[model samples]
Target: MLLICHAAYARDTSSDSILAGGTLKPTDAFDMGAGHVDPLRALDPGLVYDMGARDYVVFLCSLGYTQAQIKSMLLPSPGVDTSCGGDESDLDLNYPAITVSDLSGSTTIRRTLRNVGRIKNAVYFASVRSPQGVHAVVWPRLLLFSRRKERITYYVTMIPLKRSQGRYDFGEVVWCDGHHRVRTPLIVHVNTTMDGGSSSGSLGGLQVA
Candidate 1:
């Protein structure tokens, strides 16, 4: 039996549906293509985003979880200490997706990628497509992975060029290493208001297909 644990969240369900062009329901979750399992291909996935226990603790801390609350969630393990001082930025969680909510203006998000390709040194190029009325910029357009599990960080900035109140825009940022295409979906919600008050905006999440 193959067991795959999927994280459950309100956004994951809805976002997966939007990406798949399916109904907005929990049952549509597998339509995103991440749930599909192939034993043969799994044997040699070129690259993967590796997350460790510390990464999760840091992610929880960034979500404003208290030390006590975070500690309570941890299972007993040897040589593992719960620390809450990791990067508090939501975008730095080492996740496969990128999501940003509550955007009033221009904002930048950071992401790190790990290289697990069979080749020792592989170069990946970055390409991005911005949604309507939005300008997206990526720094360090070229990434070179020298060793296995080598990680690199890149930043994406989304700037609102025009007012599109309560609009959901979809874009994509992809990394091509000739053979494998590592793609990350970029979702931006425009919440421009005349008085600059809080307004409804859509959230962004990561997707790999």
Candidate 2:
């Protein structure tokens, strides 16, 4: 077997996310909404740098799964666990020590992992602390199965804290290069308490499959 490593740019258009209805801050372009609350205020202003990081789609797309299907999986389920270590009262989080502008622009964000990424199971874990010192965690997964010529991407996200019910939104992973800058246009809107479970919006032509 040949172990060939390759990079690819895959376009996935997802069912519209309900978390899409929010205000995007102009200063750094962060999404703000009912669920997008911040609780990390005790830290020093120097540490205010720990606010959090998020990436919202600059555009929208019509793709895989109907709105109903997407809503079923993306929304919050009753039986799901909302706290780490099985305790919502005791929540702990380690925020990234960097800011959006600090990331390297030259580095490219990988959308898919060639053959393995498409076949194997994938998960996205997100956590945040608001200006009030409240912390929460979220786990989003992408399951994949192949059928003939078309490859489908699955999206499933879970929040692990009851307190975070309406204090967080989808966040984007970002990096910056020393010179020119490049980033994936896919932005996610994560809401734990929308009429539906959650919602998403996209920018550029980027869409989740």
Candidate 3:
């Protein structure tokens, strides 16, 4: 059985349902980094594909699921021309924007898959602590592309991050319409104590027939 040792808080289940188009089954509670190492350096990485109306991005290691499973979970959210890691402008329709909070002020980073063309692998950065709390950063060097129509997308992610004395976990989630609205349960987070510095986590999944 696949068990994820992380604590998950249901932000907006209804909104998530609307984006996923169905129910979600998550892994058991699991810890990130503590001992596990980032697996996306050369083995597993992130990926994206186009499916006619909607585009799909497979964040392989986000929840310990495979690229096939990730894509399957996102069957509901579809559209746009899939692109990643090459030209951020290519995916300008709506980029994956992240809002990070720290001691200073909150900073928002727009991550467009257009940088790497495609996700091949990812790495974790050093652990950083702020007034918001301890944060584990997962950085990936990936592979991205554009797909047309409904297609079966496949990929893998094996990155996990480690924290301080308190427990920590990491996962990925898809937020559409707005940040508060999320779906597909691909979001990564740590749920335990902080032991060490930074660690890496991966995310991947695929759409099957």
Best candidate according to lDDT: 1
TM-score of each: 0.70, 0.19, 0.20
Clashes of each: 3, 43, 89
Decreasing TM-score order of the candidates: 1, 3, 2
Error of 2 at 153 (Å): 13
Q: Is candidate 2 or candidate 3 better by TM-score?
A: 3
> What would the per-residue lDDT of candidate 1 be over residues 24-45, giving only the tens digit for each residue?
4443222452344445555545
Q: Could you say which candidate leads in TM-score?
A: 1
**What lDDT tens digits, residue by residue, belong to model 2 across residues 87-135?**
1110011122111121111111212211222322322222223211112
Q: State in Å the error of residue 50, model 3.
A: 17
Clashing pairs in 1: 97-206, 98-206, 99-204
Where does model 1 exceed 4 Å of error?
1-44, 193-209
Candidate 2 Cα outliers beyond 4 Å, as residue runs: 1-110, 113-162, 184-209
lDDT (C-alpha) at residue 144 in model 1: 83
